[model samples]
Target: MTLDLIYSTALLLALSALYEFNIRAWGQRLFAAQVCAGLIFGAICIFGMLHPANLAPGVIFDARSVILGVAGIFGGPVVAVIAGLMAGAYRLWLGGAGALVGAAVVTTSVLFGLGMRVALRRGWAQPRLLDFLMFGAMLHIAALGWFLLLPMQHLQKLLETLAFPYLFVLTPSTALLALLLNDLQEQRHAKQALARSEAMRRAITRASPDLLFVLDEDGRYLEVVSPEEHLLYRPLTETLGKRMDETLPPAEARRFQDFLLQTLKAGTPQKIEYELDTLGGRHVFEGRSQALDIRVDGKRAVVFVARDITERVKAEQDRRVAAVAFESRQAMLVSDAGTVILRVNQAFVDLMGYSREEMIGRKTSTLRSGRHDAAFYEAMWESVRKTGKWEGEIWDQRKGGDLVPLWTTITAVRDAHGAVTHYVATMNDISERKLQEEEIRSIAFYDPLTALPNRRLLLERLQRALTLARRNGQHGALLFVDVDNFKQINDEHGHHAGDLLLQEIGSRLGRVVRESDTVARIGGDEFVLVLEHLNEDPALARTEARQIAAKALLTMARPYDLEGLVYHASGSIGIAMFNQAEVDLDLLMRQADEAMYQAKHAGKNTVHMHGG
Candidate 1:
């Protein structure tokens, strides 16, 4: 072979090697580049054969446009134009009548390339069998027209011999090869689409928070996402390939088994609600199962997705509890860390005689009375700060300027870290009980008629005085007094007038004694005085008793006007000094009573002393 033929043959071999390598390494989807390289090499072979000095120009074929046309249809315009240029330039260098024919082939290749380029620019380069056939016909027409027009007198017999075989054999073979290449390209594209779909499925399942699992018809776990570690707490590896009962608790596993069986039998999706224990807490999951047409690994299976609803369930329970608490009848107040009232229920507002707007944002101390000092509050806080609770009676003021007594229990609400966040106080009003207690005290200690302390209180005070005098080694005295001619005043002015005179006498008696003395009514028209810390001399006691008796007599003697009726009254006084011989309260009372009898027996409205 000539060097030019040898070189052209070598180029063809190199192009074929490149096409095979691209098909093996990069797959058939990128086969357009390989096809372009083959067309260019074929064009170079044709140019070399057309040169008489290269190989006598007899081996050359005028159908080189077919290869370039195929490249144009498949590999697009750029590859076609490049292959045509190489073929036209080699033919010119070879110097023959076929040079014109090669130039004509180049013109057709360029036209096809430009036309394909325009079509591609308009988005028409996509593979279609109709367009392929049209391109093949165009290549045949162009090559045959040029061949028939060529004037080669000596080559007519050779052309006739070659034309029939080329038209019948090479054209059909090239068309079949082009169709096969298109089929291979389509198969490669389909394989790529399937691979992408599988990759997308894997990515979606791996990233999903919801648990994705599959189980067999007999309720054995078949496949799971990331099927090694625990999705929540239970390891999927342990559960895999095991029967449902062996993997989970008996009840839960049985339920899952039943769901799987139902889905497999019915060929429809099934849903089940079950509780799952996780690191977060107990969660409620809605599991949906469906019979899968294809098994993951050759077992009849059901695919399932479990969605968590733990927060929604917990929120529903909390809402119910809050509803009950909000409608509770007891007076309740929720306060902030600083004791500012945040919420006050209807009962609290009604009990405290305040509106909701008036109470909220107000400090609890707004209801505090000056009765409890700072020490009392400090002790309360000491207990609260230590134990997170304080419960006691609090004297609070009402809006109407009346004291409201309440028994309150306060609890400190804390967060997860045990920091005090708020305070919840429940209060019960005890105002009615307090009022009743005051009424009972008044009835027990004060005389009903005179509003003065009765003899019961007087005896108690006299005993306290005796105790004090004994402790200090000091003298104390008790004075007993009786109204002189109290019956005569009743006889002259009726019992109403006598009652009025007695009220006047009680007032005058109170005026006669010092503020430190205890004056009490022992009985009708009889009174007692308790003298605390008196002078030791018995005569001084007598003198003080006589002066008080004189003052009382003068005040009572002047009170004669009563509803336009005139009346008069006087009193007799007796004084008894504290002594070791008569130290007890009863002895003091007896001695002072005997002295008063002595004074009355001696002269009315006079003063007398014991042991005189």
Candidate 2:
């Protein structure tokens, strides 16, 4: 039995060695090779070449427990189940008093090994050498218990004679095999890890854009790895194994040596910026050095990576200059090609009352005032595209939704290639200046005393109304009104009372006309009322014009209370009607003036028709 058991052990050991030889070729592939192994082991068990010890006429001792247990430990549940099924089914086919016991042995061995695998994987038990021994011992101990499944009389005889040596030899041998396999598996993993690490190192060296160099404490070049040879001032073949001072200029060599010393002393990393001449041009480089634990030729070394940053440095300087201008006092905004706002200045926040977070990624139309039509914007952008810039008054709404007027200058910021990458709009709030200009214009063209359009504005309106009336084949009239007895009120109540009377007259005349009509105080006690859009009926237009002139005269003639004094005033009005056929503003004014004298001569506070 001892010699037979030894033969079984030799077969198991031989198979383990042979499988290890081709383990890598199988590539794991999820039990592709493990299933083949399980089948071979199952065939060996069935042929009885491995079940070498006969315990009784129908009972045998074999390493089937070790085979399935090893499968469970290494091949997981899928492998264990298939292998156990194969061996157990074939054993049942053979049929004997010990067949059921043999099947139970296969099931229990796989179960015990699989349970240990799960516990180790779940960290319920640590995977150590002792854990392997304990697991292997469990599989064989379980095999001993399967004897009860056999006939009680035969089991008692085997237990009395062969149980001791069977357990003594099988238990340790199972543990020894498992330990060897686990060691071999660990060694295989270590070799895989080393190969992967070496591959990663080579990949990093090849993929990096920066120039890398390995240097000793004496600044001798040990290794140079550069993706682009044009970046190096000298060829690497001539510089390898030579001191930096021999290959580089005196100043640059001293700079490199100093950097090396600093890295070695600090035993950390350092950074520097330097310029070197290359075949392309004088290039700027940013270099970083890290102290290495490695030694070359009995000397400590450091690794240095130098990256060209000439264009990057120049761009940074340009950006700083632009930033100063971009963040100036004016409200400014910048947008991408699609007109989505990317940035806004501080002044924009203050002017528009919108925060950076609220505006970025939003369209510029968020602040649209709805004053300009779409055609206006289209034209403006077309101009900007053509000229690369445009300056004009634009209207935009504030964050509180107020329509704000702006004097904006937009510039199409182009890239070096002259492509419009972004648009910058610098705006100034022109609302206050516009309000001031409106006030100045009002003073220039309006009567200060009555806040009515003065002679200048009145003439302008007359010209426009006459031109429009002619174009539409309509009639417009001009009423020349002189306040009757206006001098009497000024003399009795002083000039202040006279001014008040004129103001009252202006208000009354304005009320009698349409909002589109104009009432102006040309001077003291004299004013003009321009009536427009009297329709196409010439006679009816003349009748309405006379009635309006009469109504205004009566309003002015009514008594006015001025500074707690009752004062009386009246106006003599002369009406003149014309169309585009008589389109001369000066001739119309003369005709109206001559008729005003006719009204004064006819009778005061009366209306007279001109050119009659």
Candidate 3:
């Protein structure tokens, strides 16, 4: 009996070796592997049963309890159920008085193994040698009670003889088998964890844009990891196991050596900005080096990471130049895409009469003069959208409520995608230029003394009026007036007083006419008035002209104050009514002059009409 049980124990140990090698390969397909494990456990039970320590005809004791319990804890409930069913079915096939009790023992062992599985999973028990021993002891204690269902003769004999060996030998075998499976489970988990960690490290190294290097304290390259081969000064085949002095220029090699020494001494990360002549081109790099915990080839090691920053360095330089140019003498304003002011230079502050604090964070509309309509501004911005620039004259208000004309150029600053990111405007104050232009125009077209339209301007206006009347079928009048006895007054009161009288007469004549009429001082002591938009009919037109002429005579008849001395002045007026039908401009002027002489002959200070 003892020899037969020894054979059963040896078989189980051999099966455990097979499990360690083949079972883990089946682990990926969990249900399939569990079913397979159940079959294997069932086979092992059958082998144990075939060679059991038989005390009766159909009753047997074997390592089925150990195998099923380990299956429940490791292969889970699936293996436990299949193994228990198979072993119980076979035991019942060999019918005897102990058959039912043997099947019951199988069921009780599976249930107890499942319970231990739950305890292990919830951390209530561990898969250790001692814990498995306790588990086997408890499972077999319950299994021993199931034998009570057997025949009284078999039960008494089995307890007296087999109980001690079953409890001592089989229970320890169960623990030893469980401990073997536990070691297999822990090894599988360790391998999986290591695989995942290695995969993650490889992924990070490949995905990184930086060039990674491992160097010794003597500046010898131990390893290099670069995703892009062109980023390296030389290929990895040539770079590895080489000193920096052998592969790089003296200055650059010295720089790397110094950096490596510093990283080792500091025991922390150190940073440096450097330039490298790579296969691609000369590039600026930002390098960070940290001392490693281990040594390489009998020397302290460091890991260096270099990131290319060529574009970033160039952009910073460009920004510095732009900042310097922004503070130039010309007034400049910068705003965001939303037209909210961001920055204004000192020149802009002086020109706008507003401090920098008041303008920042405010919209550009805050400086609007309201001189331009909405449509005008819309068109201006439209040009900037299409062409990226708008340049012209704009009227903007200053802080003191004065409007200034500025020749402004607005340029849109765009990003790489051609989206407007900011607006840069340069302005020049044109106020002085505007004043000078006005003075030039006044000199060309106006009288100096009376500040009225000169003869040149009068003739230009007269020509325009004739063309207008020709189109509208209306009559216009030209009145020519000459002061009475002006030569005598000039001889007596001097040219100054005579000049004063002419100025006053010009003023009075202007008061008597409508704003649309032209009151021009064509010569000394002579003036011409061009009246437009009179009556359409020739007869009514004549009457309108005579009425206006009589009013002008009365205005000239009023007393004039020359140099604070009251001087009475009078003038004779000649009226010539003409329509567009009159072709010759000189003819109209001659007729007005002839009528003026007629008034002078009839009596001074009187009015006469041509062909009346």
TM-score of 3: 0.83
Model 1 ranges with Cα > 4 A deviation: 1-323, 467-476, 489-496, 511-516, 533-549, 560-564, 578-582
Clashes of 2: 1
RMSD vs true structure, all candidates? 11.5, 9.1, 4.1
418-515 in candidate 2: lDDT tens per residue? 99999999999998999999999999999999999998888888989988987888888988988776667667778887787778778888898888
Worst 10 residues of 1 by lDDT: 50-59
Best by lDDT: 3
The clash count of every prediction, one per candidate, is 0, 1, 0
Query: Model 3: per-residue lDDT, tens digit, 490-540?
Result: 898899998888888889889988887899998899999999998999988
User: Residue 500 of candidate 1: its Cα lDDT?
Assistant: 80
From the highest lDDT down, the ranking of the candidates is: 3, 2, 1
| Shift of residue 304 alpha carbon in model 3, Å | 1.9
Q: Where in model 2 is the C-alpha error above 4 Å?
A: 1-208, 214-217, 220-243, 246-251, 264-270, 275-283, 290-303, 314-327, 334-345, 354-363, 378-390, 399-402, 410-424
Worst 10 residues of 3 by lDDT: 16-25
Error (Å) of candidate 2 at residue 272 is 3.2
